[model samples]
Target: MSPKEENNIRVLVTGGDGQLGKCIKVLEKDYPTLNLSFTSSKDLDITNKKNIAEFFKNNSLDYVINCAAYTNVEQAEKEPDKAYLVNAEGVKKLAEICKKYDATLIHISTDYVFDGYKNTPYIEEDVPNPINEYGKSKLKGEQYIQDILGEHFIIRTSWLYSQFGKNFYKTILQKSTTEEKLTITTSETGTPTNANDLAKFIINIIKSASSKYGIYNYSNLGESTWYSFAYEIVRISDKLDTRNLEKADNYFTLAERPTYSVLNKEKTLKTFPTSIENWKNSLSKLQNKMYDE
Candidate 1:
């Protein structure tokens, strides 16, 4: 059944405790019409096919926002099997169930799926060549959804940060308390996405109930290097001066990152048309929220 035909859209969100999941939960009040069920990994293990089958058997759903993923890029290198088990195989399991139930699936993906060699913003149609295990696993999951089901939306985002989780924004804020100066990477560039912004966008998609099912890119409107992002976090918070920011070609990471992963949002803008905030403006708002918390 089409989601719009349902009297009440019963939506299920996996990875309920993650950053994006928390953002969705906070926005739940705004979307009272949706019967949203948030499920953590423990609440619903996506990797166990039998368990998922049982759960789907008991519950009826119209849509699913799959927030579950093994997002530790560096750690993914050490445990590619675990990454695939969750990101690829587990997602495949979810897609199959969604197909069986005739539910629309909305999957969160990453800009890391690309090799970051191109100088231009990445459109949805660009060929994905992931440099890291995490990206490869995510791409595999996307492929599974594409091959298995026609009713799905795969959103590829970059540099996701939020107040609710351990993200780069939080890390920078925490470091400012103890460390007088910070060194950040300037070689690599990508758009910083606020989880709340992405959450709201997802909700808009569900609310629109449009069947324009395909891949899309979503992130804050501008691009920045890690150094500039860190600088903005500190500057907006009024916690430190710009002199505290230092640039480095690289620090240390177990996984290799792309030099650029800025996603093109023209398609998304045409679809949703909500005002996309500049990364700095979003950061300032987040800083205020963090202070209030």
Candidate 2:
């Protein structure tokens, strides 16, 4: 085969309906060389081994971007089993299938894996001590991928939001329009990552096709508490005067969250030729995009 033919890659993205998945779909147009196939849960359920196996048998895949995850933090505490079923066991099955098919697995993880005991950012080598059921479940998924697949890139991100799906960014924007008073908590601290930025980064990794496979952290440059994030959103939307936004030291939540869960990106920076954007700048960009749309 010619060099161009050999370089042509077929990528399968699971959970194509999620925020990150939808962002990837939007950016797929830019990478014409990549043969990208997106699948929703209805089409390919990761939790079902037989379903995954059947899909893999019929399709030729070079890489599998596993975006399918159980992401409800508060609900996970109430139903830990449901979280593990998708986040852990489902991911384990996906990893095993990817290994069998000789395909590279690009899995999405969360910084919630850390307990947020340390004041500084968490690195790839930092031992994960998840405090919540959601975090624990995601950590188990990461562990499964590491144990089952050698060719994998497990990216752990934080506070992910975008123009699509149900996220904090959308929530704040929605609340600003409806609610007169908004009380956001300062209990948890983490970087608010733009899903579009992360989607681009993941696509860039696939384009590079580099063999440096392992866990990596990818988030926007800065950190903020939930209150600060909401304040910024209100400020940018010009809703500060009309809407009453208050900061609370603590808020009642079903799941106990980390006080700080910022992820270090030194490894991702050194490995990839991409620059990370600041949280505020990315958020502004998304806000503008939402307005334009």
Q: Please state the error at residue 150 of candidate 1 in Å.
A: 0.9
Encode model 2's per-residue lDDT on 63-123: one tens digit a residue: 9999999999999999999999999999999999988888899999999999999999999
**Model 2 RMSD to the real structure?**
2.0
Backbone steric clashes in candidate 2, count: 0
Clash-forming residue pairs, model 2: none
- Model 1 lDDT per residue over 1-293, tens place: 54354448889999999999999998888777899999999989999988888888888888899999999999999999999999999999999988998889999999999999999999999999999999999999999999999999999999999988799988988887778788999989999999999998998898888889999999999899999898888877765677877899878898999999999999999987577889888888887784222
TM-score of model number 1: 0.96
The alpha-carbon deviation from the true structure for residue 159 of candidate 2, after best TM-score superposition, in angstroms, is 0.2
What candidate 1 gets wrong by more than 4 Å, as runs, is 1-7, 290-293
